[model samples]
Target: MRPKVFVSQPIPEPALDMLREVAEVTVFPRLDRNMSEDEWIMAAQRADYLFVMGGNIITTNVIKANPKLKGIAMVHRRLPVNNSIDLDTAKALGVPVVFQYPWEPVYDRIAEATCDLTIAMILDLAYRLIDADRYTRSGRTLQEHTMALMGPGVTGKIAGLLGLGKVALKMVPRLRALRMSVLYTKRTRLAPAQERELGVEWADQSDILRRSDFVCLEYDYNPSTHKMIGEREFALMKPTAYFINTARGRIVDEPALVRALQNRTIAGAGLDVFWHEPPGSPEMAPSEEFFKMDNVILAPHNGGATWDARTELTKATARQIVTLIGGGRPEGLVLD
Candidate 1:
């Protein structure tokens, strides 16, 4: 009999087809909502293998109940710990848990796509393109010397980066090409030579918020960084400056951010993530206040939603699952 494989969340159809060739596959029905704990437990009782994704927590309880599980495969660029997978329990039970390489093509594709979205957000805010589009679409015509759509120019402006991770590194050239000076802040300061080569100046968090024309959050979110951008941080920014976030939503205090936008603490904002937007959760409801504001721009966490990126991620993850199912170790992947 073919082994039964349960996918905890929706993935690209192509990956599903690949798994179907070797196993009887079951995918959680809700594409816009997260898989419930009850569903996960019930599936574990019957599935011979499990495929996990996103911020789903594969707890010790889930693993302990699924003794028949041959292997569990996960897809992510970060450490499995970030996903809350119980590595120790899985190891104790001798159920190999697999993840793609940190430098795998799946992550490269996501980083590139996210970089594209980040630049697009910057451009849209710098030129107020979306606001202009809305006015035009609402049956308003452009008039002579009305000055209704004038926005801060991108050239010669300062762009502050909150994190200097892979995506932020990729964004350096794009910002430079627009003639914008770059400033970055992270836990570890880059070497002076690397700074000179990248044309970025190191700055403290406070300085970045105070001096930058565009403050972009590209950092990771952990307990220490939770709600890092708050009322005081917004107050430090120039009243004419803009805020952009492509990072996790919890990184910024949602209420504080909303208050800032309403009070005009900052000139405008471009946001692609929001509070309560966990992985594989399509039912995340964004703030209605953002929709009412003309100065704010929003996306549905679509930075890494490009077809190429998603396809590569699912395909790579599928390959890992296929190998483990066949009792063969996957190349360029970590199995524990």
Candidate 2:
């Protein structure tokens, strides 16, 4: 008999087709924006496997309820200890938990794409050109202006990968090719040989902050990193610098950023994530003032939305589920 799996959230159509072929998959009928503890427990009881998102909670209690469960597969890139699947319980239960490396391609592509965008933004391409059609009507030319980037990640390559993890590994070569230098400050430094291999140098966190024209927050969030870039850090940045945060939202104090932009403490910023997902503010979209002013660019967390990236991610998730149901080790097991 095929194994029964419970999908706790909506997956794209292609993944659904693959899951149906290998397992009897049941997804919850209505999407709950956030699942309740009771719903999680009930879902665990019903399936041999669970494919979950990073935001979903899987507590010890939820794990204990699923006696028949074999593996919990996670599709999100970063899994914190407190939230999401409980690796300790899974280990005690002798269930192998898997994580799909969904962001690899997306990170590689974005590092390259972001470099391209950075060059364009530096050259003031968008500012210099008015819509050709609009030009005839207004008879006015917009003066081209340069954006002063706060971090040196894209241009100088003096980028510190807050965490020396997989995403940073892929981003290094791309940044180097664009004549950018790489710097990192972490709990443990990479050996001299490893740094040589990637052309990355180490910097004290403060030095990375003060010198970089663009600051990319590549570190994962922990208590130590939460609000790491607060008011004081912003104050240290050059008036011409722009900050870029594609990693997480809470890493920067959002309110501090607002004040910095308002007072021109830093030139501008580019943000892909927000402290609140789906920020329920009066501003409806990426083009609003909180983002579209003199020095900011906002993307709706679309760095990973390319067709190739999504297809690779979906296939990785499907393969993981298939391997688990076949009584074999999933290819990329993350949790012990």
Candidate 3:
């Protein structure tokens, strides 16, 4: 008899088929709703392994729900991230947890898809695409270029990236293609040789904020990043600049951002993440003000959400579960 596995969320068909070959797969039906803690524990009790994705609460209690649980598998951001998995407990129970490593054929493609969304957001704001769409739909036409929807164009502009990690690194070339100069900042600056190689310049956070025509956040959300961008930070931006955040929302103080947009402290904002995201679908975004602002372009926290990308990511994550259940160690960054 094949082992039983419970999947916390619906993954792409290829991944589900892959898992089905290894085990009897039980997938949660809803892609737009998260499982409660009780629901997670119940699922754990019935399965030999659990495959979970974003928003699933896999606490220590859930891990221990069934001592026979083989392992846990999921796709997440880079290694050593603050995620929902209970690593310590999983280790204590002798169940292994898996995460992807950058070099494992997942980073570049994932980075590309994500950077594509980031650039799309930047372009949308720079050209006022959404506003133009609404205007035309509202029976408004270009009468005489009376500044109805004029915006700062991207050519020869400056794009300042908050973090120069994988996604941002891939973004550098894309921004360059649009004839934009790139400035980047991180806790530990990159080597000068790497800077020259990547055709980027290292800049202080203040300088990036003060001089950039577009400010973008490209890292993860953690305690150190909690509310990193605030009222004072918004004041540092050029009023003609646009702000783009495909990173997590809590990194920026949403109210401060709202104030900035409300007062035109910055020319506009393109947001894929929100400070407060409800479970399941992004239908219940906490920031209502963004929905009303024409200067803002919003997305459902789905930067890495292309059909092919989702299938590949889910399939890659499922591969780890299959490897572990087959008595082979997962190739990913193994935690205990």
Candidate 4:
């Protein structure tokens, strides 16, 4: 008998077809919205493998219901599997859960998006591009807008990366292309060859915070890194610096960020993630004070929502599932 696979939410057709080739695949009937926890458990109980997507909560009860489940795979980037899955229970049950890491082509798309947002935030905040466009649309001339809005240029500036991971590595060339100096800080320093190749100099966190014209957060969020940029870190930043976070929101203290902007401690910010998300959810407000700031540019955490990235992520998830079913160790296996 072929091994059974259950997909808790809809995925790309290509991945579904791939699973079908190796296993007996069962998917939740609805593609428009996610199934309830009870529904997910019901479907999961019958399978040997469970492939989950965002919005499905896989609790201990759900895990226990599926006695035959050998593995679980989360098919999205940045959505940590531990967030939804009961990792401790899975570990006790001897079931391995896997996630997608930002690597190679995966990092490429996300890095490109992050770089674009970083530049855009700097330019938008400094030049007041949105306001200028508004003035122009209201029948103002270039001279009036230029004179009123004296924006800063990006060339010959300093940029800081919080982590020297794949995304930061990919950003090196782009930052250099604009004639900017790059400083990075992480727990472990990169090899000398990597430093020379990427043309980045290692700096202490405080130094990067103090000297950079643009400070971008690209690190992973965990216990130690939670609220890593709080009042003290924000105080260390150049008052003229523009802050950008395409990473998780919990990494920065939201209250501190708001205060920084309000008191002009930092020039401006471009935020793609927030302390609370999916704007307008009961968890938080969609139009918070940040939305009121002309200096802040906000996106709905869509930095990596491109079609190509989504397709590739699904394909990667499919590969991992196949590997696990074959009794091979798949990449990105989350250990408890």
Candidate 5:
């Protein structure tokens, strides 16, 4: 008998077909949202492998309900937190949970999205693109507009990256093409050869803040990094500098960011994630203040929401599922 796989959320058709070849696939009927707690527990009880996505809460109750379950495959691009899946429960149950890796196929798509958002934020702040669009739509022309909205250009500016990870590494060439010098700060410094190849200068967080025309946060979120950027760090930035964050929101203090924007301490901001993300509601943003601010660009925590990225992530998850089912330990095993 083929192993049964319960998918708690909808994935691409190609990945579904891939899993169908090796397992009896049972997908949650709803494609627009995740399954409820009861539904999730019921599904877990029925399947040998639970394939989950973001927003599905896999608690200890679900794990204990299914003693015959083999493992779980999570299709998230970032590190899975306890809210998504209770790793302690899975560890206690001796069920391995596999997560997606940054070196996998979906990293490029995420990197591209991050870079795109960073540029969009810069252009919007520098030129007031959103305001200009509103003016044009309201039957106004350049002749009627004054020089009040004129802002700085991006060429020959300094761009700072908080982390030199995969996303930040991909952003280097793009920043260089704009004739911008890139400064990066990481826990461990890169080799001289690598720095030369990527055309990035190593700097501490304070130096990056003081020198950069644009400060981009690309670091991972953890206990050490939580609230790393607060009022003091924001105060270090040049008044004309723009801040961009495509990584986790908890890395920066949201209230402090709101205060900075309100006071114009920093020029503007572009944010993709938030500290308190309402479950299954992608339309929600950080706060009402961000919605009213013209200097800010807000996304629904979906920087990597491109179709290509989704397909690639689904494929990667399918590969991991197949490997686990075939008695092979795949990469990104959360328990081990």
Candidate 6:
């Protein structure tokens, strides 16, 4: 008999088909949307392999119940803390966990690209080039503007990355080419050699806020990091700075950000994630917050949802699960 696998969330059709071929796929139809805590554990108990996406909680009790379960496969690009499978508990249960973050490195590339794009927008470079296209017709002179940046993470690294990991590693040379000075701050200390290797230097966080022409939030969201940028942090920024947040939104207090944008604390903000997913009522499914304000750019968290990108990730995740169940160590395992 084929091994039984429980799918705790909806995945792309291709991935689901692949799983069906390898295992007797038992999908809880209700779970195709989101699974409740009780339902999550029930699903866990029935399957030999579990395929998890964002919402399900794989607690210790579930692990203990699923004596036959061998491993877990988490398919995602960014494995936020809230969504991470409890690694310590999984280890205690002796169930190996595999992570398929095929787009992990791609996030840095997007960050770097967006950073460059934001800077160009701030400098009016792209605007000017467009203007130049109709220069003869419009008779308007091209202009450049200055910007101040805030925060030092993936987006901040676009101005120049501080090299937190491999994703940050790729942004250094591009930043130099654009004549953008990379200023950043980190919670940890690094030797001069390490700094030179990544081609970035440490600066006070506030200093970046005060001096950057464009500000980017690139840090993760956690209790310690919640509202790392509040009224005080926004107050430190130059009024001309165009704040950008492709990072988690909770990092900045939403009310404070709205106030800043309304009062013109910084020129404007571009946000990819918000404090609340689905923003308001669940009845308004597939909801977004574009009606809230003009200065803010509220995207539906599609920063990396390109078809080729997500499909590749789905396939990679399915393959990883198959590999681990076959007793081979696939790349990107979350549990050490």
TM agreement with the true structure for every prediction: 0.84, 0.63, 0.85, 0.72, 0.80, 0.62
Candidate 2 local distance difference test against the native? 0.67
Flag clash pairs in model 4: none
What ranking emerges by TM-score with the best candidate at the front?
A: 3, 1, 5, 4, 2, 6
Q: Which candidate order results from sorting by lDDT in descending order?
A: 1, 3, 5, 4, 2, 6
lDDT for 276 (candidate 4): 69
5-82: candidate 5 lDDT, tens digit per residue: 998777789999989999999988875555667787888889999888766777788888899889998887445444
What TM-score does prediction 5 earn?
0.80
What lDDT would each prediction earn against the true structure? 0.85, 0.67, 0.83, 0.78, 0.82, 0.62
Per-residue lDDT over 111-154 for candidate 6, one digit per residue giving the tens place of the 0 to 100 score: 55544444443344213333344454556554544222222223
Best candidate according to lDDT = 1
Q: Whose TM-score is greatest here?
A: 3
Task: For model 4, state the Cα shift of residue 226 in Å.
Answer: 2.7
- Writing each residue's lDDT as its tens digit, candidate 1 over 1-336 gives 999999988888998999999999999877666666667788888998888877566777788878888887777654533445778888899888877654456777898999989989889988888877877787756675558889898999999999999899999999999999999999999999999999999999999999999999999987789889999999999999999999889899888889999999999999999986654243466789888998998987778888889888888888888987888887634443
Give one digit per residue, the lDDT tens place, for model 3 in 1-336.
Answer: 999989888778999999999899998898666788888889999999888776565788899899998888767653455447778788788888777533446656667788999999888888888877877788754565758888888999999999988899889999999999999999999999999888888998889999999999986767888999999989999999989998788889999999999999998998888876633232336578887787888877777687787787888888888888889887774644
lDDT of 2 by residue, 1-336 (tens): 888888876666688788899999988665436566688899889888888754567778888997778888877655444356678888898777887665566456545554444334432322322223244456665444324322333444344455555555666676677687777777888899988988888887788778766566667766888899889988987776667776667677888998898899987776777776522221123334474465566665555555555555666777789888877777677644
Supply the TM-score for candidate 4: 0.72
lDDT of 5 at 334: 73
Candidate 2 to truth, TM? 0.63
- The alpha-carbon deviation from the true structure for residue 24 of candidate 6, after best TM-score superposition, in angstroms, is 3.7
The clash tally of candidate 6 reads 11
Question: Candidate 2 or 4, higher TM-score?
Answer: 4
The sequence of per-residue lDDT tens digits that candidate 4 reaches over residues 23-90 is: 99988877555666687688777888988865566778888987778888876553433456678898
Off by over 4 Å in 2: 1-3, 8-14, 26-48, 59-70, 76-82, 87-96, 101-204, 220-224, 276-295, 299-302, 329-336
Where in model 6 is the C-alpha error above 4 Å? Answer: 8-21, 26-34, 38-42, 60-67, 76-83, 87-96, 100-203, 220-226, 275-291, 300-302, 327-336
